[model samples]
Target: MAKALHPTQVIVRPLITEKAARLAEENKYAFQVHPDADKTQIKDAVEKVFGVKVVKVNVINLQRKARRTRTGHILHGQRWKKAIVTLAEGHKIELFEGV
Candidate 1:
């Protein structure tokens, strides 16, 4: 069984990239999400926080990246999950409108 998650914890933040912005036009919005969150949890979180009806949720697990700073310092990025949330055909998430 999946553990319950607060709406805020489930959705870490909205993803703002050129690719994600384009997808938003088609009623699909992307977000950085909790690593342990599943599709169901993501869908519910989006709906509860955005006041929009979610039709589908697709998840992608991201691998940590290895980075080397100019000073030769090694920095390891944390692993996280990304969720693509598709809203109902006629509905939209207003938060992305002005962005």
Candidate 2:
């Protein structure tokens, strides 16, 4: 994170799932972030892209999972990082509101 990265490049996409849906109630939102992006980058990206104040940032590295193909060959999934961003109270991302 030496040089600043664009918000779009820093944050890959929003992580929409049952677990994430539940966490949203507490002002915490999940996102699929670039592997090279750190917590600080994540916080900056979320704030710039979503126009919301970020309270905290938590990140996790998701390991690549192996999947068997039809011919029994192993296919490895891509390794990516996840960011759980907590926003300041009363601030919201419209993209997450059933969009």
Candidate 3:
């Protein structure tokens, strides 16, 4: 069986961006989560850490992109996972409130 991760380990950080802000208005929030974590783990982590009811969870795998340096070499960016969590209608996470 796979080892379970703690809530803190599952959630890397809150994604604070223009798009995230707009989603928050509709009771949805975005978080940068552990790439290995699944949708159910993300849902449980969000609920446990934020103390909110999770209505739905959506995940997106952001692939690495290749970029060239000024000198000459090409490098690839790191791959990460993003989770868009929709909370229950009356619930809200305070962290996104002021942003």
Candidate 4:
């Protein structure tokens, strides 16, 4: 059987919470990405979109947790991956500027 080679898509949004924003300014940018996305794809996407040299890419896979609704219905959260990309020192991406 032959498998398809669909390229992983990169979502162009950063986690801009207080902590994430601080980290981004400190050379660590956090992004919510696809679970199937690998380190190389992440690093390349970040560099290409942000125009910064990615030093390293750290991926974290998060498990979906079950949540109960007010109507007593239970549902599972979405499973996804997060990437913490470290950029070269002195190089910064201004996506969070004035935010």
Candidate 5:
């Protein structure tokens, strides 16, 4: 059987890009997540780890980009999925508290 994953495992990392930062300020927690993870898993994980109620979850699959390497060779970046989790009103996560 597949070993159970902790709440932390559900969320690989909180994406802190310019766009993600703005969403975070608005109580939207965005993260790069496992491609196979579903909405229910994401909701449970976010709430369990952050101790906050999840209002909604939006997921997007981002394709890897093809770029040129230093040696004039073509390479592909990694493909990953992203999840935008909206927390209940008045709920907040402290991950960006000091940043």
Candidate 6:
């Protein structure tokens, strides 16, 4: 069985990007979550950390991609998971407010 994860451990960091900023306008925020964390865990973590009601949670498994270096060496990118969290109406996370 997998060990339980704390709120901080579940949510790695907020994904601050152009696309993410656009989604924030729609009451949606993206976060880089632990690979082992599920949608329910992500939902709980966001709500607990941000003190906001979560309307929905969506997760994406971003597979590692191959990259070629200048020396003709092949490398693979790190595999990570992303979570898109939609907050309830009238609620928003303060961290994303200034972005």
For model 6, the run of ten residues with the poorest summed lDDT: 1-10
Considering every candidate listed, which one attains the maximal TM-score? 3
Residue range 1-99, candidate 5, lDDT tens digits: 334566677788888888877888888878998776788888999988889999999999999999998999999999998999999998999986544
Per candidate, the number of residue pairs that clash is: 0, 0, 0, 0, 0, 0
TM-score, ranked from best to worst:
3, 6, 2, 1, 5, 4
Runs in model 6 lying further than 4 Å from the true structure: 1-3
TM-score of each: 0.90, 0.91, 0.94, 0.83, 0.85, 0.93
Any idea how many clashes model 3 has? Answer: 0
- Score each candidate by Cα lDDT: 0.91, 0.90, 0.95, 0.78, 0.86, 0.93
Please report the candidate that would top lDDT against the real structure: 3
For model 4, what is the C-alpha lDDT against the true structure?
0.78
| Alpha-carbon runs more than 4 Å astray in model 5 | 1-6
With a 3 Å backbone cut-off (N, CA, C), the pairs that clash in candidate 3 are: none
* Tens-digit per-residue lDDT, 1-99, candidate 2: 255677789999999998998899889999999998888888988988888999999999999999999999999999999999999999988877873
lDDT of 1 by residue, 12-82 (tens): 99998989989999999999999888899999889889899999999999999999999999999999999
Query: Which window of 10 residues has the lowest lDDT sum in candidate 5?
Result: 1-10
Q: Any runs in candidate 3 off by more than 4 Å, and if so which?
A: 1-3
Higher lDDT: candidate 1 or 2?
Answer: 1
On a 0 to 100 scale, what is the lDDT of residue 50 in model 1? 84
lDDT order, best first, reads 3, 6, 1, 2, 5, 4
Poorest 10 consecutive residues of model 4 by lDDT?
A: 1-10
